[model samples]
Every structure is written in structure tokens, then in C-alpha cells.
Target: MAGITGIGSGIDIDSIVKASVAAERAPKDAQLARLTTKTTTQITSLGSFKSALSEFQTAADGLNDASLFGTRKASSSDATRLTASAEKTALTGTYRVEVEQLASASKIASGSLTGDSNLAFASGGKLTIGLGADSFDVDVAAGATLKEVRDAINTQLNEKGISANIISDPANGTSQLVLSSNKTGAGNDLTLAASGADLQGLVTNRPAALSEAQNAKFKIDGLSLESATNAVSGAIEGVTFTLVKAEEGVSTTLTVGENTTAVKDSLKKFVDAYNKLITTTNSLTSFTKVGESGEPLTGALLGDSTVRNVLNGLRSELSNTAAGQGGDPFRALADLGITTQKDGKLAIDDTKLTAALEDNFDAVGSFITGDNGLMNRLSDRVDGYVKSGGVLEQRISGLQKTDADIKEQKADLETRVAAIQARLYSQYNAMDSLIGQLTRTSDSLGSALSNLPGVVRERS
Candidate 1:
């Protein structure tokens, strides 16, 4: 309508309306843009801070374990024969082991058969599978083929760890149904019994043991020990040996010792992670220096008390001395050569730390992983911030809500501005119509005056 509004009035109504609308929109647009930028920056900064906290927590977790300081390194002279692993409780010593036999699962093959094409198993007949003193019966449905009966047993009694399979023995030019036990032990022998003639001939009186169930026979330091499985435990305190195969005459030496390198590596990771968090917090909370022609730039979280509190809390926890250690032997991170730098970052003296760990390994473990240790305290603090309803989480949630509010405000502004534009157009159209009517009225009066002969009428 504004496009045709200025035609009668000889004034550009469209331009006037556009200018008015733009003036009305400028302030709100600028305000919304500023708010959006601030909210987005806060979200990104909080995300970085949270990620740094999580990473530092992970590093702290690595050192939180007492066993990390007492980690045992296990090695087998011949890995092909056997492999070993040791835990923190493992003693540092050398052990000679010889594996005589590997524990085997019990397997039985039925007498030679032409094929598993069909079987005349009697209806409602039952097959009993025995493992040690435990046994379960599988019902043989009427007119079940050998394959169908195998499937029924597998589907029904599979919970008992019994598996049935039809294996083709080309070497013997015959096919046989095989049943095996899932467990490995001499006591876990597989025995089968069938009540029906069809099943009895096929499963009962299992032809000469295909492979007898045997226990893993091995000797540790010349002391004979038997295990139900290849993985033998309790032979050595906190150490488990896995027997690969029998090496009758060969003996493998297994040595267990403290893994000092691993401990030092974990400590260094903790230090590095702590320093990273310090750097991130500094950036988030600190301000940039004034430029040559502008004022100083504030950080995303500048003037935020939460940021300051978090940093201060972490520093306090890190600097505190752990309790439960009677003496100052290794009670603080400083004693382990992890000192606080002037910039609030942790700096590790590798040589001093290594010497400290080597000299008092157990005391160091007790100090860092004790009930009131640095890691435990710090972990608890960080958990509060990142866990449900924590300070940081709540802050982020509030910021998001503010963002949502801003979005709604912008939408409302757009609606109001559109309505204003429509009103301006309507006003201009009414003004144009009034001006056109006035012009026509003046022309009619001039014509009437000219027709009275007092005024001359010009020729067209």
C-alpha cells in the first residue's frame, strides 16, 4: 500500500516508513546481539573449564590408587609356554615353573553314524547330561531327527553349559554327534544317559573317551600344584599364571618386581594435568592488558566469584598436607617434589621425585592415597562442581535459560516492529486519500468561479 501511497501526495511514503521502522529496531537489535555474544562466550568458556576439570580428575584418579606406587612388573622367560601377572600384593621374587598338562574340557563323540539325516527318537523320551554331581534332563520330542534332538538340547539345556554339535569325521568316513562341557576340570566330566532305544543307541555308553577331563598340572618352584583351569591362582600370592601348553622338560622363570617407571609416569601425568587446569583457570578469570588505543578486555568469567572460588579451593587442596602419616616422611605433595610454582601451576622435579619414591615407596603411597590425601580431597571437590546440581552445572543451566529468554524477547520485538510498520502504512494511506480529496475539491470550486464570467477560463 505504501508503494502507491505517495502517488497522490507527491511524497515518498515508503522511504519514510522504512526509516521510522529502522530507527525503532536499532536499539533492540544491538541489545540482543550483545546479550547473545555474552551468553555464547560464557557457554564456551564453561565447557572448556569443565573439560579441564574432568581431565585433571582422570589424572588424579591414576595416582589415587595405592597399588600404582607398588605396581608389579611380571615377565616370563618363555611366554609361549606360560604367562604371568602380578598385583600390588605380589612379592618381588624369581619363580621357576613347569607345566605338565593343560586343563581340558570333557568331550564325547557318539559311535560312527552314516549321517544325521533322521533319527527315530521315541516321543517324550529324556536324555540326562551329568557334570560332576549336577545333572539336567532334556526332553526328546516325538519324531525328532538327530539334528533336531541336538538343537533341542542346545536350546533347552544350554544354560547348563552343555553344547551339542554334529561333526563330520571324513577321516573315519562317518558322522558323529559330539557333546562337550563348557567348564575345564577333572570333576566336570561329561556323562550322558538316554532312556529311549533310539537315543540310547546314539548317546549312551559313549564310545571310548574321546578326551578325558584333566586338571592343569604344574609345579611352581618345584612345589606341585593342581588347578581346575589353565589359569592358576594362589600358587604365588597376588600372581596368576596362565598355562599355554605342556612343556615337559622346559622350565620358565617368572620374575616379579616393582614397576617404578609406571609410578613415575602416572605422577608426571597428574602434575601435567594439574598445570593445564591452572592455565585454563587463569585465562578464564584474568583480564587482558589495555591496548594502545582501547580499554582492557575482560575475560569471559571475569569478576565471577565462582571461578575464583574453584581455583582457590583446588589450590588449597593441593597445598594441604595429607593426614594419617605420623611423621613428615611423605605427607605432602611438596615432599614428593611436586611443588607449586609462582604462577600457581605444579612443577615436578623428576630427579627429586624419583629419589623420594625410591627411598620411601610405602610411605609415599600412604601419604598420597591415604584417606585424607590430595587426590581424594580434590576429587571430592571437583565431583561437587560437575555432579548433579553442582555449582558449575547450575550456573551453566542458568546461562542457558537466559539465552532462551533472549530468543523470546527478540521474537516479540520482531512482532511489535511488524505491527508498527503496518500502522505506519495505514496512516500514510489515509493521509494520501485526504490530500487527494482536498485537491479535487479545490479544482471544482475554481471551475465554478470561472463559469460565473468573472474569471476567464483558459482554453485546453
Candidate 2:
């Protein structure tokens, strides 16, 4: 196949073989090309479609929560003095809150010692400190300085809500060791006891406390209440009051009510997501023409039954009214001012939605998120197509398999074309060799006859 093929016959064997191979491979090559293009486009299109559906499903799931409706918003008239927060279980009402006192932590300072902070104590001993219901002991070494004692106390008891430090009064040439309790409340006061002369001096000769531990005392609606910490909870169901400062003679109003804004925002998000999904589907299935030639451009998913079915399923869910809302004023998304447009997109009526929520907030939740609700149904329907091993995945996988098959066919075609080209070249080379032999044989016979003295030679 690689020899000087056309020399004997004066024919282009390489060119002929190339043409035959092209002729043999053209049809299958074109078919495979078309198949590959189409299959790749469809896989990409289905991927886009699935992504859009997932977004819409996520939006639906977010709104399909019963707690969203039960959410409560709490506000305080004087947030500077008192701030309140409420959970879903909090009853909606107005209460007058008065912050009489805020809880404080205890701070005590030892009598000033006329020496450097690093001065050694008279003798080492066991020092005990108590906070709340917990206590710890620090063993001071025989020659421990004031700083060492402070360090040992801090190292041993810092995590227990107690700290010790030396307050150096350089102007008076004295240093006072101060102990403070981070734990607030009267019952959590810090107590100190020591066993050696130097340690006992710190405890027995302590000055008046800078501040005493006290519980926060406040009143809600003229009902007295006290809390060990300023952040008071459980006094009111599902409500927490953080007492910031004392307003003994004045009261701030605490307002607990339904969080309609959250519900409205969630509904708006769902509508937006649904509308976006519609837009995506429409684009993916659209067919249009462009340019002066008016060449038709088609979408990858055009005429696809899966796309049609998915859209129809979602539409059905959106249109149907949820059951079990017998006496409820709202039973569907339409009743809550969410309606479908002609183009299969959703539109919101802000005024109508606000009025609906204000009038029947609970019923609105029931219609959209309760048993057999629209969002729940829509979510379930979407799951059928988008979940693992679902319709979209199966279809895309089939298309991918088809694409793979096309590739294999193309490879097979290439191999066959190579064989055909080789065979054509071999046949052409053999014919050329035969022609060369015949010409050589004729020349030899003519020369022998001429030389044998009986052959006539004539000029044409």
C-alpha cells in the first residue's frame, strides 16, 4: 500500500484510495455528528431545567413551615432600659415592664499593704475563695510574693467566674489586692478565708466592698419578678427580658404580636422563585427566527414531553385549593392574593395580600403549608422529577448513553474506512504491477522477433 503505486499504470492510487475512503465514511460520520450535537444539547438543557426546578423547590420548602406563621415579634418602648424578645409560643399581648434594678457582680479590695507588689508575704498558707456554690483553694508557697499569690489565684480560679489582681497605689506607696466575682446575684457573693497570718491579713482587714452582688428586680404588669441575671426568661411564656438599667419610677411597654412581615416576605420569595422557573422553562422550550435569512433557531428542549409534564404538574398544584380548610377564609394561594398570569408566571397583589394576612394569618399558613397544602403538594411533585434516579436523571442518562454509542459508531466507521482505503490501495497497486509486466513482456517479444530475421517492423 506504501509503494510507488501509480508508476506502471500512470494512475494516482493514493488519491483514488482517499476518495473511496471518504465516500465510505461520509454517511456514518454525518449521522454521528448530528447525533452527538443533539444528544449533548439535550443533556445540557435537562441540566438547566433541573437546576431551575431545584431552586423553585427550595423556595417552596422554605415557606412550607408551620412555625413561620406562629413567629412572634417583641418590642420595647424604652429599649435603652429594657429589651424584650419572644418566641413562637409567646402569647400576643401588651405588658408594662419596669426595670427597678439590674443585677451586679461583687468586687472586694484588701486593705492596702505598704510595700511593692512583688514584696513577699509574711508566710505562705492555704487561701480559699468561694463563688456561687463552687469553691477553690490556692496553696501559696512559703516565700510567695503578692504578685505570685494573685497569679496562683487567677490560674486556679479564673474559669470559676472569679479573678484576682493587685491594684497598685504608687502615689501612696501601697498596693491593694482586689478580688472580683463575675457571677452576679446575692447568693453568688464571693467569700474568702485564709489559714496563715499573711493570708488572714488579706481576708480580715478587707475594706468595704466596692459593689455587692445583687439580683435584678423588675415588674411586668405590676407583677413582681426577680432574676439572678439581667437576662430574665421564663417569667413570661416564650419571652426574654434583658434588663439594661433601672427605671424605678417609669415603665416601658412591651409589645408581642404576630410576625406578619416574615410571612409576607416568605410568600414573596416563593412567588419570585416560581416566576423565575417559568421564565427558565419558557426560554428552554422557545423557538424563534433571527436575521434577514430568517433561519429558524430551536431550543434544546423544544417539543420535549418531560418538560411539558413537569410544567403541567406544577401548574396543577398551584391551581388547586387545599382541602380541610372548611370554615377558613383562605384555602388557596389565590385567596392570599397570589395568582397565576397568562404567561404561566405568578403575580402578587400587595394590598390584597396585606389585607389577607392581617385578616386571616393562620388560615393563610394552613392554605400554603398545612396538610395537603399547595406548597407541600408542589414540593412533592417536584421531588418526583428531580430526586435521585428520577425522570430527568434517567432521561439525561439515556441521552448520554446514546452519545456514547454514537462515539463508538464513529470509531468503528473510522476503522472500517481505514481498511477500505488500504484494500483500495492494494488493488490499485496490483493492477499497476500487472500492466507494467504486460508492457515489459510485449517489448521483449517484439525485440526477439526483430532479431530472429523474420519479423517485419513498420512505422505508423
The list of candidate 1 runs beyond 4 A from truth reads 1-4, 54-77, 85-92, 105-210, 255-299, 302-309, 312-359, 380-431, 454-460
lDDT of 1: 0.82
**CA shift of 244, model 2, Å:** 2.5
TM-score for model 2? 0.87
Off by over 4 Å in 2: 1-11, 77-79, 114-117, 132-134, 170-174, 248-250, 321-326, 435-460
Pairs clashing within candidate 1: none
Model 2, 221-305: lDDT tens digits are 9999889999989998999989998968799999988888899888888988888888888888998989878878988888989
What lDDT is reached at residue 243 by model 1?
Answer: 95
lDDT of 1 by residue, 1-460 (tens): 4456776688789989999999999999999999999998998899889889889888887788976876787889989998988887898899999998899988887765655446455554778888778898888887887788789879987888889898776665566778888788888888888787666666644588677788999888888888999998888999988999797867999998777778888888898888899889888888777878788888898888877777788887766764545765876688888899898888888888889876887777777775577788888878887767887788899999999999999999999999999999999988888898898899999878878955766779
lDDT of 2 at 244: 92
